[model samples]
Target: MNFRNPVRRALVAALGALTVLGASSLHAQEIKERNLRFAFSLAKEHPLGVGAQKFADAVAQKSGGKMKVTLFPNAVLGSDPQNLSAVRGGTLDFTSMATGLVASIDKRFMVFDLPFLFNDAKEAYAIADGPVGKGLLDDLSAHGVIGLGIWDLGFRNMTNSKRPITKAEDLQGLKIRVIASPIFIDLFTTLGANPVPMTFGEVYGALESKAIDGQDNPVAVIESAKFAEVQKYLSLTRHVYTGMPFMMSKKTWDSMSDAERNVIRAAAEEAKQEERKVTAAKEGQSVETLKKSMQVNEVSPAEVARLREKVQPVTDKFSKEVGDATFQQVSAELARLRTASK
Candidate 1:
């Protein structure tokens, strides 16, 4: 062999081997270790809490131990409004919160809580997973947050110590504790009831002391918080289809690689599906549990129709307040979903 040729061949072989080894190591490093902390307002037994756990599990699994999620439930970190501020400030990485608090940031989010806007959970999911929902998420980018997907908090029902609410008139004069959302206040006020806007942590005490005569929440939430003990009547108003947004800090999200972002998005979508299934099952069971402890009243279709008619103007008012264009878009998308589902 020519000595120069041998030397050149040996150098080429070593360089090729090093290149291969470097690529392999880079591939391995692509799946680097990261820990994401998430906070929520509900306790571990609630559906939101359950969904958060599922999300954390899925992220860890899909990322192959590269990404880990730690959950802070029961408002361990703080209330919904507080955590939302924290996330925006970059002090917190991620959170799932009631859209009512989010509505304060962008009034368009109130569309989700508009009374009777969604006929059912499927309809709600369709709208949230479609263009209107994506637009709403894009809108959040300006507020220092990014909305990943909607997590089911289930449909809201009414509970009161005064009496069972059968129709719009029945709600009159009842001091109903509501989340600090303008839509809720407008809806309840329109129906002739006193809407007392307050924090979630304060609701139980308010109800117990008769500081507020009643409050609205999903069946699972009422049961989980033992509201049945303070509340004498449970009315299946299903007034609003409630859901939470899985949101992340804009700073944290921008720092993530495209691959990492994809993993988190897929995990959130998966968790949303799981949450819907569990919430549907839990609602009925929670009702049964509440029936044993308090009087459970099912409002007939006729009564629900009456209530809907009474609240229609409230929706119109909200549309005007939120801007007519955004409301029309939301309504049109929701209509398309309903027609398709039917």
Candidate 2:
């Protein structure tokens, strides 16, 4: 502690600084220069597109331009389900897809597809980003994909070229285009509609050709895909809360060094929040925009009650399918989150 020992003090400080700089240099060297691809079904101007850009920017910053991610929007790499398959087979790098689309690979993902499970985005996030969500993500390792994080896809409402759907019975006899998940098929079928399993790429044409009478998606999707041009009614059923998981292929993830992985994880985490905000902000505007082109109807609370009651059987069936313990725990978590948020 003697200041008079200038030579010794200067040596010590220099050594300490060198040690820190060396560590930083090593970390920086750990990131290998690589370009990557991220695909999603939403249009580039959509929130998912914004999120992908945010993630790509963060990766660039973290890797010092050594890593780059190109965005593929509007199912150019194929539909969500197809891209998911490619990711699993190690042919694709990353994609953000609805949990229901992922549920086709593992039924557990469908647990989020339960109708009326969450009352709002806040409650949904509380359940999804917490332990229940972690477990769901963790289980993906066995399926050859790395589950990065889940973002909000907002609540799904029904849109159709047919009459407006204000009650569960209105869903009856309508051939609705649904994601290629069993739960969607069952959900629509139980409510009396014939569910036609189709990918996002086929929806607009299907609606245009009258191959399907209606489809369900968040308002953002409806607007981005220009569904209003082909469909007449936009029913605010808010039947299912959708979850989007940013995922990477296990092959791509396994090849990355720990430093690279850390940077990507941090970037994804940062981008996730911004993506949710973008999606939420666009939702209101999207709805208003659609109203200008289509007959938009808000399902009455009494009718929503009826829809939930009708879908209870579908819920019970999926609970058993996804395992009673998981279903019960998720329900319990949502209850806790709802009460706490209140």
Candidate 3:
């Protein structure tokens, strides 16, 4: 019937041609061949490493193989500091490090590193994925990095070659390695332990040689890094919750088309959820694995309360350093979450 009508046939042909042109235009705007390097200071089997690979796979699939994200784990690219500099300079495309290390780039991030700031991952996630966290992340545009989203690293515990830390006083006189950040240094100092600001890569050697008596990190890190071989004690202090801030070089981000950015942002969000799930599941297993080789002990709630009291000064000091407004904002948010839960 259409073949019998030239006008009807022409209308159908025009519509089909327009559809093809539109698709071609959309593809040209959104897809491009790209190779990106993502580096971090953890083994491939670590939760963060697992998340990075998930992100890479999602990116490749989302872009239909137009974009490739290469992962460099275990500090193969460089230490966290070196990688941070490279990312800022645009030589590296992405990296994630402890929020404490990120504090060096912007001290405001120190708010997250405050001792005993978070009781668990649920509270931490609320602070990170909520308004205050997004605001702090948005502020990173000035530092030449695009803050994607915070991935969970879980609560940090203490390990040492010395006796178990049953109370705050037990930590006294221990040479504990800490992230190269002021709050950590002050926190350990206030607790009477000699704080050694060190990079994650140097920690194993330092502990093995007895240069440092102890170090605190999430169980996943301690297990993945095999600290159990050299450290004799594992104290489940859960004193601080560490969040991995996944970021992109602003230069790389600015160069992307809207479509490319969308793919990246979505991939990061999905990978973040996956990372948190894996991290939570692995923590208990890591502790169980560690118990086989280390004298693991749980710090009682009463002692933990005393530990929190001892570090109050350090928290107060950093509350001013990170800016009263930023500090107060987080405190208010935490209060609300706690109240609602009760």
Predicted model with the maximum lDDT: 3
Screening candidate 3 with a backbone cut-off below 3 angstroms (N, C-alpha, C), the clashing residue pairs are none
Over 4 Å off in model 1, which ranges? 1-24
User: 1-342 in candidate 2: lDDT tens per residue?
Assistant: 675798989988999999999998999889998989998999988888889999999999989999999999999989888899999989889999999888877788788898888888887787678887888888898999998899888999999988999888888899999888888899999999999998898999999999899999999989989999999999998999999989999999999999999989999999999999998899999999999999999999999998899889988888899888788888888777667766
TM-score of 2: 0.96
All candidates in order of lDDT, best leading: 3, 2, 1
TM-score of each: 0.90, 0.96, 0.95
Per-residue alpha-carbon lDDT of candidate 3 for residues 151-177, written as tens digits (9 for 90 to 100)? 988899999998999998898899999
Instruction: For each candidate in the order shown, give its overall lDDT on alpha carbons.
Output: 0.87, 0.90, 0.93
Off by over 4 Å in 2: 1-5
Clashes of each: 0, 0, 0
Using TM-score as the measure, which candidate wins? 2
Give lDDT: candidate 1, residue 264: 87
Report the C-alpha displacement of residue 213, candidate 1, in angstroms: 1.3
